[model samples]
Target: MMMRPPLVEVRGMTKRFGALTALDDVSLRLAPGAFHAILGENGAGKSTLVKCMMGYHRADAGRLLVDGQEHQVAGPRGAHHLGFGMVYQHFTLVPSMTVAENLILGRDDLPAVVAWAAERERMEAFLRRMPFRVDLDRAAGALAAGEKQKIEILKQLFLGRRVLILDEPTSVLTPDEADQILGVLRTMAREGQVTVVLITHKFREVEAFAHEVTVLRAGRRIGGGHVKDLTRGDLVAMMIPPMLAVEALTVLDDKALTAVRELSLAVGAGEILGVAGVSGNGQRELVETLAGQRSPEAGLIRVAGERYRPTRRQMRRRRVFVLPEEPLSNACVRTMTIAENLAFRNFDEPPIAVTGGFLSRRALHDRGRELIDRFKIRAAGPDASLDTLSGGNVQRTVLARELSQSPKVLVAQNPCAGLDVAATAEIRGRIMAARNAGAAVLFLSEDLDELMELADRIVVMFEGRLVYETARAAADPHVIGHSMASHL
Candidate 1:
């Protein structure tokens, strides 16, 4: 028997952005009609590689071979014409459009003659073949996350794409939703309809669905093999670098309307307390209360030896900082200069402002320059607008400013959410460093793998209650997942 060539292949691929080499001499191959997984930390070149494949970013070097033939794909259209399609983490559907209309988008093959009745029937028939039914006349925008994801796949299949790439497809979905979407993809692959490439951070995703796995670290391929041949530890070791850990600090959050109820836990002074739960499971409320963005309707809060509602002045005086999700909007001012954003905490005091309460530009820039260097922020200079930098750089700026204050309590919500492999590592390292320096860190994330790696102790939030608590050593994904979905 002869071996079939990969449906897609990249050889010696390299991509660079200014002085940064995002991808270097990376290569990968995907077999036809198979479910393959690309695993890496943020900045690990997974997105870069996907971009290269989608023709979003043409490689600076190397060749992209498709079906045993070398071709230079000019852009997304070319990739689409070459039988490739990608479903991003965010939905690309038009909310106003009907399911049938959305599915027909970008199609150049529609007949010149009008036949709305027949087209509707055809669309309905097409949807029937899917594992789940989606009403053709229903508004796409009104659909659930799982439905939208299925629509993405259906659109690809409708377009005759032989290769489908899903980038963190399950990031925003519940466990059951994830299972449903991926289950449909698995069925698609099993039926020899399309080759699937799952780009994700979860090991369980790969174990459950992917037949083969490829690991990338810092722009290079570190490991590749059959999923069965790799152990859970093997994947973890490849993904998580090294980190520092710390002592414990305690927190108690009693009730509210459908939020946390009597949630009391302790995180040491030099420890990372990981909070895990399906989204909307009081994690948001806990984070908000800790950040002082919202006052607890009724509960006692204690941290850094203080027992009271943490006001802005109190939080700043106590050196408590928060790295909220979507830092560009929540943690920063887009119109402001990087220097000004960095000086937000200390703008009224010395080094950033004069004793007479005058804004000192020179002092601020000097301090900003120091932090930019320390945090490896890739900005033109301290004077550059925050809007000009990438997501990772914006996050770095946020971390730089917060950590520079030498905070005693650090509250981070999905700090590494949309970052690449390198940036994620850097942020995690900074969190660990803060812990090592005696900061009590409360880390909340939907990413189980991340929580498992960095946390000294872990807890789960479900229906406004702390349902499960355990040391990191005993934090099993299966157990945590079970507790996450449980109402009791």
Candidate 2:
């Protein structure tokens, strides 16, 4: 009898970032034509482990075997050399470029003229296999989020990728879009196309799509086994959650806190009402409305006893600040220097016009130094591009800039998702500090653990409405879990 070869095998993989240990002797196996899911909590080693597999970060110690042969991948190109491709949470597609341009970015065989014909042929062929259809000539940026994902898929298809690593592929996708992508994945499997390593926090996704599942906690591989053998509760227990530890007696001030926080259309000033739902609930809309970025019909916003609807200018004047769920806010461009972005938020003197009509080098660098030192952000230097910073550091920069605004109401969503342990602790502390400083924090998060741990009062958001606000002590994980699932 002959033994079957595993599609990909990782053994004793370890990665360290100075004092932080992200992956510790972790290992995983992916079989051919299998949909494998990697699960973990917010600060777990899932992201780091996938990084090692993708060849973006080299493992301190590990052996990788593909098709029973050893493989050494130094970077994305090296991984591509070994027939592995990746679809990141954030895409790499150029919004202005057409689909064909993105597909044949670095291939040698397809020359400039031939590239167009070859890409178009390949794009149509791959589109036939996929569930969704996209115009091959359309600019990627104009496509919907789901359609853009199809282009990402086509890029891999053009490269003839065999093993694919998807990092939080559905985070930005709507439910319908998620369904379409998963369907395409299943079609690929039915046709014996490729193997997938899905990195996600969605518990239900594993139960539905995965053939085999691997769960990681902290920086260690805790369990790996058949998916059919586990229950949802079993999976949750495997994640090793931390205790809430909030006592009823911990409340110092509950004057504005109502037993049931009424959240119909109007909420008052100096009210730090919290919104807690499962990760993908429609909390995104409710906050955007109050933040003055999105307009709501038939809704009136009253600030400090003055009644008027929210406007961009009004939100500007009222000091309304919004902290986006994703670490990099639209306000912070990842490519720009840190000081340049930070200067915009500092909001001090008149904007200085320099020799190049850009930010003054010395002024930006000095301000960047102050913010990084003050926030303990990990950065090479003040001049470093924001993209070089880790997810945690980028988040810290955004927090520092927003908090510097000292707003009347802080409307924040998922302020700590994908952050490291130290960063998560630090960012959460800052939000609480903001509340202590008398700024009303409209905290929103899908991680019920975070919402419960940080919020003074919690409101359950299902679909697009605020359902209820349970006191921190009275909240039940099961109940919150049910409400979050209700929207779906």
Candidate 3:
């Protein structure tokens, strides 16, 4: 194959935030028409690298070469001029606006915020030209994880981007949704529609979607090569230094843990089943599938001894609720008022009639007030926009609604992921309370210390499969650590 000219080149890129050095002379070359995957653990340099490219952060030392010519991306606007576009894991869109308005949001050509005849017509024209498909009038806040991501991608395409950077784009999507995204990328690559680079910890995605892969560890570029030539083990080893095993959080009697070995375990009605694994395991799949977002191709799901599976209708049932890891993306509607987002989770409700079936606005307001006071949600009021609250507060608001329904099965995926030490403890306590109340809790988390403290039985998931289960007492960090790594 002939070498295509590089689209962007970073040489000796070095950056630091205050006393912490985020990038240690990391360098990467993204070639034209090639899909590149940047792989690393959380807090690694993956996000830092992308931010530097977008001019969100300035590099203390480095040279950026675009089309073989040096360029300084002073800010987001400057990056746009360079034909660079981005779709973040957390989308920024107006929830009340129609999809078409969001697709071309912030364009100066529009006189008013409302979708006019010509603008809507043009948006329709543009939508037909692109691979994105879905209803245009639907509120951005009402869309699912996958559908919302599509709007973000469409935003970039409508801006006439030649290169698109997607950050953890599939983190909240279902397996089928993820496959659809992969197909769209494949089509774009085949037709040379755009140059794409995605940042993720999921190695399988690298193999499925990227032509080349770059591994980073502790702010340094460790390796780069064709994705096909690398195994998941190879990538994991490169991303994290070799070590014997992670220490166990606690100890348990081996013989007493035998009851945990069931291939398929069942928690009685109102019982919360917890599964604790490191971040990026199958938690996303676990919650999403259980919430009816994923349709399992192999295994079976049964509720009350009847085969239960994911469907649009199932999701609307509200039987199972998920408090996703990505709070801003999944838990709350960023731009919508708290009242409006609360309604989105009411899957049990029928569609609004022509006259519009109502959620008693006053009743909802009082209920929101109660939840805010109960959960200590930091929001202005029921009318307050959810975007104004911090991540933890937003998560608490989402939790209020989920726990309100008193779901039969509640899957809280990484409930404490980005919280402070105290906040983590607080959220974990709430989860335990749910379990004590007889709710089946699938507490999927990476915090082993947490699992040791909360879950009666802890399970480890490796590469899309559950590898082992042990009593909380036997939850040695090393065993779980080994299970988390190449042992799978």
Best by TM-score: 1
Residue range 140-180, candidate 1, lDDT tens digits: 98999888988888887776677889999999899999998
Q: Please list the C-alpha lDDT of all candidates, in the order they appear.
A: 0.82, 0.72, 0.72
Q: What is the lDDT of residue 225 in candidate 3?
A: 96
Worst 10 residues of 3 by lDDT: 243-252
Each model's backbone clash number: 16, 0, 17
What lDDT score goes with residue 73 in model 3?
Answer: 85
Error of 3 at 401 (Å): 53
Ranking by lDDT: 1, 3, 2
lDDT (tens digit, per residue) of candidate 2 on 117-232: 66577667767765666787889888888888877876775687778788899998998888779777866754567788888889888888888889888788878688899988
lDDT of 3 by residue, 1-488 (tens): 11222478889998999999999999889878878899999877999998898889999999888888999889888877777888888878899988877877755354655547877787778778778787988999999888888888888777777778889988779989988986797678656777888899987788888999999888989897998898886786687643111111111122322111112444444444456556554556556656665444345555433455546456445366678778788666789888667766652354311135554666556666777888778778878988888877877777777777666666787788777776666677777777777666667777677677777667776545567777676678788778867445
Give the Å shift of residue 21 in candidate 3. Answer: 1.0
